[model samples]
Target: MLFNEEIQRVFKSDSWKKVNKKLIGKMLSEYMYEKMIQPNILSEEGENIEYSLQVSESKHYHYIAQKRLFDSFDVKWTTIYIVENDGRKEADSAIELLVDLQDVIGMSSETAGHLIKEMNSTLIADAHLLEKEAKRSDELIHEDYASLEGYMTGHPWITYNKGRIGFGYDDYLAFAPEQQKEIQLSWIAVHKDLASFQSVEGLDYEALIASELSEEERIRFDVKVKQHGSEPSQYYYMPVHEWQWKNTLVQNFPEELAIGRIIPLGKGEDRYLPQQSIRTFVNITNKDKHHVKLPMSILNTLVYRGLPSERTVIAPKVTEFIKGMAEKDHFLKEECRVILPGENASMNVNHPYYTQLKEAPYQYLEMLGTIWRESIYTYLEEGEQAITLAALLYEDHHHKPYVESLIDQSGLSTEEWMEQFFKVVMEPLLHYLYQYGTVFSPHGQNTIVVLKDAKPHRLAIKDFVDDVNISDQDFPELQGLSSEFKAVLRTEAPEGLTQFIFTGLFICHLRYLSNLLKNNGLMEEETFWSLLADAILNYQSRFPQLEERFKLFDFFKPELTKLCLNRNRMVDYGYSDDDDRPHASEFGKVTNALAAFQLNRTVGSN
Candidate 1:
């Protein structure tokens, strides 16, 4: 798989020009609405009629629409045509008819809106999946090729093409018939399933090598060899379960040298089973590095063994290490940080947990590490510290600071700061929470609010944890964790989860939005109550379970409004610094002021 830069380059190449054209045409027609004006002449005394004037302006309403279309499509056109005709009423009618025609042709406003949303969603999902697949494919290909190369160097006489193995004339002539016979007999004796071979008569080894042996002679030879086989031969018959030995033999041998003595790769105390391999190559040149020795096939297996498992999530430590490296080197932040924990660890084949969870920690970590190193790390900067932090905080991706050093440095008035804060940070976050069921938001620790030119313009959510509990049936893996950890982590099983969500909402989102509103002189109690109502209404549509769990609408309606009003009162009564509760009259006065602000804003606007 190619790198992200290469993929993007391909996307922008001349071959994609056709796709761009259609995309641009669709974008323009969708956003560039024609405002057709129909001017009708009205007589003061109803005495005379005059010709009407019609004007049309084909103006693009949203800069975002234009920018997105241009960036995605790279269209060639710069200008669009606009027509003006006589008679205002006629022009209005014509414009309406044109809009209807566009709708009939599937270019309607509603259709375009849906398409745009879907396109954005598809792009994000595809990019993520492609990166994942590319990493996996690359690791498999690299390991397989390395193994294959080592095998070829060890057994030069064994020709391998397109993953198939064949013996050449040199291999056939390398050993004498007597030696081959002894080797075959040794193999049969070592494996005793071929006891029926005791009935076989004579074996013609020399005639078999020369292809001059009779069919009966070959059959008898195969039967006898199966009784005591040692030598490796493509023609040797074996049970289906025993075929794996062929792969084991080729893989265990080192390239470019004759097999001497076999040695176990690991010590007895190690948890993994020991495998024997023949070391052949004593000296081999590496083209990539003049001073480095080419690795023997036998040694190559060691490298493969160190790879992470493919079933469990990557260990937090491994993820952090990779992330740190990437950050120091200037890797793409978004692409480098997601480390799946399940694919890096290993599992014991015989363990009950393995059967229950279908994974092991070590195996999962290895797989995760391999993927991160090959794919995400490639996109990251060579040595980034944040990548390390990201790995360490993989489980809690949303826990980050809401303010940065830059914000402190920027010397803006509190009111101006709040306006920018709400626009740039709070608005987008509220939208996300409302849409995606995201509980984590811009809190003091979970966000970094970067300020530029005395304004909070950039917001980054640090340690954002997107993982959530749905139901046990939906994600059985949650059952694998200890019950204590499960209690802390589970957001779907108990009543306590509701308090957690409320803390995330009220203490995090509401608090931040409230602070910004207070700073901006917009913290009226009525305004706060209205905002809460809007949030609840929006939330209810997405999470219907809330209606059943808390009867939230009925139980919290009065309190929610009261909380907003009281908070606003605190700001209005010149008692903002006070931590203690105030009198009822003071609270009432503040609420009255809040109500007046809402009343004035509504009536004055109309």
Candidate 2:
């Protein structure tokens, strides 16, 4: 084959073994929290516990892990060993462990089979990551925002984060974010009747087109439209991922192409880099250009990385609602100075057949759409640098955390750095939940940490089309929204709304940070979580009028519902194509560490 040399280079014996061993440790740590495999406690030594999992009559796996808050575990990758009929050996294969536990965990044969493929693909990506000589965390701290995304890994919570089912090995090499390849986006013009375009009140389609495309490029594309025997005035030009055009659009929308309803315009002048989410692209040539989110029908972390048709249509409206709040409220606008990067415009072209099909698989309906979001570069001040919250969880090849490097560079102790982090991230999120009865999924990927002099300064939250949610309870603030608007945005009950912050931020992102800090001897987990409680309490003190709302959306409860990303694929939902996208599976309850800190604070005050 074509990739003989490439394969030989990336899949060397030593590199492959190391990636698999690391993956197995992650699998064990996450599986324990999800209750997928209840391994018996073999012994205990302080926080570190030795555990044995009997996979079968003749086989068992043993490892050492440290139990942390939120009912989590940190498996020591070097300590894992597997014993079979022959003898005990160091565990080196994640697939072997998955196969051994398939029956033990009650996973169906079909699910197990698909999971094996996903796990193998994840291993391949991991091996590629391992083989490359990566920049140290300290060096990466000074990198630009767009370039920094190419360094960090994927979701901290999901084990099979890069299981991109739709991609071939060639596609993975060319398009994966870590590869950091920059390419021009291919453009397509759709007949006005077949496409719908929407934008915020001030911007229209003409203005957006003018700002995005040069006068010469517009003329060149207009000529292409005329060649297809369609008037340029009757079509809306939009950018499409080259992979989507080749893999999904040409195959799915043959009828549109045949009838001259969808015409291919050549690639644009600007070269763009794909962000962590494979579908979203950032313009590298012009930093202030809008970030483009296109549909790429790949099964990655939880859902197809495709924009939902309904959400695509209403994305700009959601932006107006979210930005409107920030503009009016003095706290959000002036005091907090939180950044809301709006989805300024969107275009959706429904599949001619799937749109009419009742309960069609969701991936087909979402194959072609684009959302234009305001660039983060446009909002940055002179001294501010923006990094995704996920970057904080990254550890370099030397096992030094990026957050520690940030703290050292900031001239602040770990506790001081952490206090500022909690305050900057929590105040805006809490205000949205308690005051406006709204919440953004402040998960690592969606939340941006704005730093000044290497210290957390303010917050910027993005990806509103998919993540912004509101309260199901009737609050006067939400009364102005139309039913259509409400329908597009997910409305959750009080606890459910709170879960967006409590679980999405605390459990999904912060718990891992706390674990890293504890492991690296930076800070105690208790002090880390206690500072978070202080941030929330401090916000409450500022807004006593929202006291009842605070009670309604209580984060200080003794326990909260546990959500599992791994279990969603491994057990409950599986690989079966459903009409709707899968969600995070709720299994049990997580002990609320913040609750304990809150109680301690109240008692000490007394």
Candidate 3:
């Protein structure tokens, strides 16, 4: 197959053109909002907004965007143009947009070139996925949870959403979530020396493995292990990403393979569909089986898609602590039915070299691990379904938002549907914040929206160890939580923890949802923000005793710390192939849309 032919086709196709423009528009708008570039604002009258940025004296990037609430941009895809000083106009491609803004964002030549490559893979992946026509609103409305999950698009806020930098074309086809392929992971036997498996009380190593494999497969696996002269008692079995085994581990540690310390035990029987997060897989064979999250050493988006060895050990412990807290709280258990899908078990293999090197970056220490998380499907009731919160904002081929699809089916007015929607999502989140000073980054992908009859139900939160955080203040509630939980969970100040909810739930997820609502004329942008305020305030009025906790972490603070994702990429090292996840850069501020609306509501009452 000619590589260039395929590449050119994806780049030039009508769908690719639309997808690329949307991506470019998003990158330009977000980077500008993050203060990476100062665009000359030409005009703003209601939604009719125009801006131009000087990439250089000779070149300019121009766009007409409908300004959404919180100053987000919904750039008109067809209306973007790159104007040359020589009086030539060119339609913007994904790569061209990155190159144009690279200098403006103060990125080095090296970073610019690398970012272009990232865009190349991203566009290529988009090309492969975008060819499929979008389903009708009715189709998406009736879509099964798993199928609907596949329909949901990439990160609502990120520009280089599909940049799986470490993947080759073949790897992209086999492992990337967009491919919708069933991946059967290869198992590896790690001698007792290098491997450590941690688990919550009930979920042991044997049970977790048995749940994923049939009895015949388990017998076959044990037979293969015995033929290799290894006993189950002596070595721990860990599931390895098949691609990671061939591409990384086998080559990196030939000594371990030769010494029979790390022996491959062939593939497991279960077929898994890669969830939206790329590394996390949902068991398609048995939906109730735990979601297997393995470390794939690909550098994607902001970090290498690898799990930290240190955190892996404590993941189950942390999950247990959070689970106990959720079940024990009346608001969480009785009212909202919040489900914290426990990270039941995890296995981490210590790096042979990185552990010895004091200053090595974190990803090197994170290259190999697995976290077996309890599946939310295990807890779903009859007629209940769960979809990624990202799907709520998803626009199908016919440009229909999933929420609107649901509203139509529920036979409820838009306001009632949306009110119910916000209550279910925000109630548990606010309960955890005020009742227990706990915070989880319920970003679009991490948060799951459970529903029945296309109406909002409750939330099922996952990705515990990495995504969840706790308050620095020692609440009485956290008294008996294990020392491992205390150590593993990041203790941030009340305000800092507030950012997890403010930035994660509000900016990362709700901002785009708000745009979808406003764009479709389902609701005004201001009303959407007001509804969010109403969600939190209504939750607040129920537990008056937690008012101090609410005051401690004021959501109504005038400004929020802007998480500059694109700017974070542009400056500094531009990212390492293997390093700790970079710190979020606070570039600038936008008016707290929630605070603004809440203040307006209070003033209106008086």
Candidate 4:
């Protein structure tokens, strides 16, 4: 009865069926790409293929799909049908297909059961997205970055992307990014003995607090801290998500609260909006203020959206390391002028019991921490706008891509716009990988594209605490790195390091953009990929001295290991509470689409 109004408004039968069909199409396409399903080809016409999959003796699914490069499929959702002994009907249930494929895909019953909840949650979110007052691509192109994120759909590849396990409907309405709700953050005081605060060389706790909180709010918070019989100087003030404080900290840290080691200090004066990541918040009251990242215990995408204790402790150091490189490199500082919005400060509070317990579940250890990242607004020049790379994949209610609107507004042909896009995004990423033996997981959310006159002008990469990785191979650039950094940051082999860019950016994001553009008749699929290949090659030509490193981190190999996100949760790492978080699963190898362009370049030159 409480959510009767919401249920009536958002959960219409027609909307459910429509969102389910779209999700079914996504499941079929992604499952095929991951090699989880191999349907027999019924017929073929050019790049279009008709396939039939038999789930049971009498149950069959038939659909026509456009076969894209990277072994991906774009299934025509309306064309999908389920054939049974009785008759034939439109395929409209994603959960039904998921259950039917459980045994076929070797999913355990426990995993299947959990996946059902996640899939249903995803469906509810999708229905709300359908019912919300949607924006057009043209209008959204001019919107500010903070407000624009709410219009986006979640991850392009993952099926259960919005499966926020810990959220009730009330929490979703209050705090979900798509809800576009702005609320003041709740502050907590942790005794200095139990909390650790770190920051860049020039900034400290006092300066950070002064910048973040108004004098009146600080006084009120200090008075509350004193009421709990603790000196203001003996404690560190940390901003926390209201949901995290209510659901996670109260139950987990009861002893600390009872002893007055942790005190609730009420809400701050500034209002903030949650971003797509859900854990990060942007200050809506003051655009230039630092964006706050707090630990939320929701299970979304693959892992709990909590900041690991080790990463939080070392975040500022990582910021200094990355920003220091850009300060010294002439290309990064002057020519390309790439932006790195640093995670300049952080506060981490480890659970007393979890810290003492060996091999405790990771979720328990990461329950309390905060990272303060420099605002993206601080870096924008006049006539410049910043949007996350994910915005490009967004489709308006009319199914027009946001990127297409930007291209139209830029007064550039699709090819010209895409060329500038690749140069802006790839040059900085490649320079970091080839020239300096470093890489960031430049996935949609982590990478930001700065646009000028509606065309990409530069790149901004963030989330250094979680995403930045280094090459395992010894390189002079990394020789001076401290052992503390070596312990906190992940190190990868040559191919593994290259996968961060190749699979993270090209395969995960650009492939979808290429498909969208081709389907919309803006550009051919081959031309789209060829332009990206050209961008990488041009960067290589500029830095011939890094030829050996280029080969070591080659992006044009004939095949590379295929990473699967859905398969990771459903087949390999189910709902187990493990000491470490789950990662993307590696299935068989996938043919490299860029390799063909490289061959073409070689033959044309010869």
In order, candidate lDDTs are 0.26, 0.92, 0.80, 0.94
Per-residue lDDT over 1-606 for candidate 3, one digit per residue giving the tens place of the 0 to 100 score: 646765665556676787787778777768767777778888887767788878888888778877666657777767788778667575658777777776677789988887888877777776776765557767777766656666656776767777788788878877777667788988888887988989999777888777777888777777777877778677888888887888779877788888788878899878888887788888888888888998887877788788988789999888877888877777789988898889989999987877898678876787788999888888899989888888888776767777888899889988898889889998888888888888889888888888898888888988987887888888987677667676777889877899898888888888888878887989887777888899888887888989899889898988877776776777864865434578677766766878787788789889
How far residue 327's Cα lies from its native spot in candidate 4, in Å, is 0.5
- In candidate 2, residue 57 scores what lDDT? 94
Model 3, stretches more than 4 Å misplaced? Answer: 2-11, 44-46, 86-88, 481-483, 577-579
What is the model-wide C-alpha lDDT for candidate 3? 0.80
Please give the RMSD to the true structure for each candidate, in Å.
28.9, 0.9, 2.0, 0.8
- Candidate 3's TM-score reads 0.96
Q: Which candidate wins on lDDT?
A: 4
Q: Rank the candidates by lDDT, best first.
A: 4, 2, 3, 1
Candidate 3: which pairs clash?
Answer: 134-397
TM-score of each: 0.23, 0.99, 0.96, 0.99
lDDT of 4 by residue, 1-606 (tens): 789999999998899999999999999999999989999999999877899999999999999999889988899887899999968998989999999999789999999998999999899988999999988999999999998999888999999999999999999999989999998999999999999999999999999999999999999999999888889999999999999999999999999999999999999999998999999999999989999999999999999999999999999999999988899999999999999999999999999988888889999999999999999999999999999999999888899999999999999999999999999999999999987889999999999999999999999999999999999998999998888899999999999999999889988998999989998899998999999899999999999999999899999999999999999998999999999999899999989999999999879989
- Which residue segments of model 4 deviate by more than 4 Å? none
- TM-score computed on alpha carbons, candidate 4: 0.99
Candidate 1 runs further than 4 Å off: 1-411, 464-502, 505-557, 560-606
